[model samples]
Target chain A: MNRSILLQSRPVGMPGPENFEFREGSVQEPQEGQAVIRTLYLSVDPYMRGRMSDAKSYVEPFKLNEVISGGIVGEVVESKSGDLQPGDKVIGMLGWRLYNTVDAGSVRKLDPSIAPLSAYLSVLGLTGLTAYFGLLDIGKPKAGETVVVSGAAGSVGMFVGQIAKIQGTRVVGIAGTDEKCEYLTRELGFDAAVNYKADNFQEELAAACPNGVDVYFDNVGGSVSDAVMNLLNDYARIPLCGAISSYNSTEDVGPRILSKLIKTRSMIKGFVLSDYASRQAEGMQQLGQWLAEGKLKYEETIVEGFDHVVDAFLQLFQGTNLGKMLVKVSDPQA
Target chain B: MNRSILLQSRPVGMPGPENFEFREGSVQEPQEGQAVIRTLYLSVDPYMRGRMSDAKSYVEPFKLNEVISGGIVGEVVESKSGDLQPGDKVIGMLGWRLYNTVDAGSVRKLDPSIAPLSAYLSVLGLTGLTAYFGLLDIGKPKAGETVVVSGAAGSVGMFVGQIAKIQGTRVVGIAGTDEKCEYLTRELGFDAAVNYKADNFQEELAAACPNGVDVYFDNVGGSVSDAVMNLLNDYARIPLCGAISSYNSTEDVGPRILSKLIKTRSMIKGFVLSDYASRQAEGMQQLGQWLAEGKLKYEETIVEGFDHVVDAFLQLFQGTNLGKMLVKVSDPQA
Candidate 1:
């Protein structure tokens, strides 16, 4: 028997852990061209909160009785296909479950020796690719220009600040806590970090970025985005990655200072990681090289057990997790 | 002596006639490198509303007690510069004055025989250039796509819809009245037009544009912009030209559909005509060619007398003007 969590109902505000219900079911045998994966880790991202809502969105909402799905890393327990064998590690979009029986073509084998398997869900996965495309493709940061990123201590934001630094741009970050701010500045190599919770957030931001922001990588949109909008230079670019601040709110209060977008001759574009799915391999190659060179650093906040999956997700809205939040679904070699 | 209207005070909302003080002043003789001009026409655009306020914007706010400046067409009464001669028709950014002295390099001498002198202040002037860059450069419309332009009966908006139609795109327009809607569709060759005053605006917009909007030329940016935002297709582009709706509001209430921007992956870019000043000549050439070929049409709402300039500007926000609103500053040369 395998265990998985299913969406119980849609949420209006911040979803409680009760919105999901854990259930046990018999594991199906791998059919032809199929492989069975023993769930190792499950990613918990803010974007997943949108999937739990019934509202119209880029992707379909999670059905009431279906398993909520996202990126997962696991080990192949059994194989009915010639392409895979037992003891193979792979990473793909598998849901919250102890075991998954999916087509072999859906999984990409991960060489555990090359990098830690968890990294496939972090720096070398959707997190890294999202930062790569959003900042470079949309933001278009130029050398000597200043780049500002919100949620800087989180997985994608951390990579965004570092990548902007690598391109010879001054990078400023906004995080939630003092500890995260220190980590972003000291370890992630951001030029400066502002704790958004501080009383003088707007002042600190202005002092840190005197040249005015040229590219703003928006992850936590709300007041933080509004403050940044005022400091944007003419013809600035904004890459909308996530709006974690509003994701939990029952009522939709759109980002303030949208009029500034017109006054400054700036651009605001929304992007989903899936939109760049076709060019992911190209992203992976460059990300892999950056990882090998130690030019990119990654961190993960891992919860101990499968039962804590819902708890891990809830932590994202409360700003409790640092970097990518993940649930250890089962023993690595189970 | 020549008559001119000077900015008496920076306005808080709509500028009343009292805000402009008409004064009589002597026209000075042209010094070396200067040309003395007798003004023929003056352009009154929605952007001038922003200049009337003291708020910081893309361009500098108009200084109190100075002449409100914009595009002007005139004839050189006398010249002390090599580039211009007496009776030469010229176009430039002169103010609300009947007669003025300008450096020869500041004005472009127009050949009145090729086109009417007022044409320099309309189709061959900044209004034409603004439409060209807003549509082609910013919107980047593809052939066979659908374009929706707000304030479609107005100066730049009319050109935007017509230009999109010229590129073989289905163009839909939103006007303030049934008469304006009829003029847009029947006279301007737009595929469809919707009178925004209709009770079922949303349904009418949907009916007018059966295909989703590919490019949105936003001029009236309030509820009208919100309605358009809801219908934007994936990868849709919005060239933000003007926001006439919010120009008169005392309180800050922005567009309510900003969340749609994220869901549809749409991009909204604010643009000022002066931002593309380096390429103004190219835009003027292209627009002039279209006008001369009779493929492009333009209308001018001529308000006579320099003293009534403020009235002409106020008419813009009321949605009363049908096309390019201009002030006839002086009698046309016989």
Candidate 2:
């Protein structure tokens, strides 16, 4: 029996567990050039919040009563294709189901010998690639420059700060709690990290970035972005990766920044991972090399069982997760 | 005697004639490397509003009780340098005085046969170059795309529309009055022009660009920009040239658009003409070639006498000028 989760209804503001529904069905038999895969791990990203709302966006809105689809890693249990064996592991954008019957060509086979299979769902996958392209291509951080990232404890934000450090830039991070702030600076080697909830957050941020911000990687927008914008140096570059803060808010209003932008001759660009689809391999290789060389490190917060998938996704908005949040459904039996 | 305009006081909000004072002084004798120039034409630009306030900007603020200087065209009346001769026309950033004794090297000699002396302050000068670089280099408008420009009847905006048209793109202009709208579409050859003051302005603008805006040349940043932002296409580019609407306002508040930018993977960059200083020659050559071919046109609103200089400048905030606003101090005797 395949247990699957579906979007029961569209969310109004902050999505609740009631918006999702669980169902059980028999797994389909594999045809020629097909494989039956047992789910191992799945990713819960903040960008998925955008897909829940019925609005025009980079991706289509999730249909009501349909299975929710996202990045998933699984083991091929039943295979009829010549290219794949029954014991091979693979990754693809798949439904939130215990078992998936898909075409063999749809999933990319993963080698567990290189890195952990779960890494493909976290630092080595979409999150890492998003950070790589957004920071290097758009932010273009230089040596001795200051790079500030909002949502510093989040999946993409963590990688942004780390990669910016690799480019010889002074990295400052903004997170919700003191623990997250400490982890960003102490564990991740960030130059500084400040709690946005503090009363003197604006002053602390200004003091941390004495030279002014040259590159700002924005993950959570709204007031956090408003504060960071005030410290932008001339010719500063901002890469708008995600806006988790405004994702749940109905009204998106803030201080108008065009005047400041004109005064400093700065630039801000919004981008998604799909914009660099052709360069995915290059990003993966560099991230893998860094991980192997001990130059880069990553952390993951894993929630056990498929039953807790909806809870894990809801926790993203609560700012509780320390790093990349993932659902570990079952261990790979390959 | 040289009659000069000085900044008597800083303005609180919108500047008035009270903020300026007239003074009389004896004209200085030309030194070995200097020349005496009689002011012919002086320019009044919206960007000058930023300099009027005692705030940090691209240019220094107007110091209290000191002579205010801007783009000026004049004729040499006394020359002690070999680089300049009496009866030669020149252009430079000079004081707003009837007579200016300046180093000859500071002013560039202008040939009257190439263009009218006043043209140096309008079409063939900073205004034209600003439009040329901001649209081509940053906006990157392509053939068959729709380009929308705000303040379309103003100096730089007029040139931006024409340049976009020359690139084979459909051009739309947004202005304050119906007469200005008609002038843009009928006289300036814009594809469409919408009066932003109309109650149905948003609807009219939507009707004008059926394909959606690919490039937005923003000059006025307020509710007008908020309206145009809603209709951006995927990968749209916005060149933040001016924010005339917010220049005098104490507080700048508006609807946030980062969500929309992420949705479209668009980019917005703020820039001044000084950023393109190295490429100024290239832009001037192109604009001059276009003007000689009868493919470009310019309009000037000249206020006679130095006494109306402050009035002409204040009129810019009222949106009364059709194009470049200049104060005609005197006719060149060269």
Which candidate tops lDDT? 2
- Tens digits of lDDT, candidate 1, B168-229: 99999999999999999899999999988889998999887788889999888777877787
What's the distance in Å from true for residue A206, model 1? 2.8
Put down candidate 2 lDDT per residue, A1-334, tens digits, no spaces.
8899999999988999999999999999999999998999999999898999888789999899999999999999999998789889999999999999999999999989988988898789999899999999999999999999999988988999999999999999999999999999999999999999999999999999999999999998899999999999999999999989889989889999888889888999999999999999999999999989887788899999999999999999999998899999999775
Q: DockQ of candidates 1 onward, in order?
A: 0.52, 0.85
Backbone clashes in model 1, listed as residue pairs? none
Cα lDDT of all candidates, in order? Answer: 0.86, 0.93
- lDDT, residue B229, candidate 1: 77
Candidate 1 regions off by >4 Å?
Answer: A254-258, B255-258
The alpha-carbon root-mean-square deviation between model 1 and the true structure, to one decimal in Å, is: 2.2
lDDT tens digits, residues B113-152, model 2? 9887788888889899999999999999999999999999
User: Which residue pairs does candidate 2 place in steric collision?
Assistant: none
Worst 10 residues of 1 chain B by lDDT: B251-260
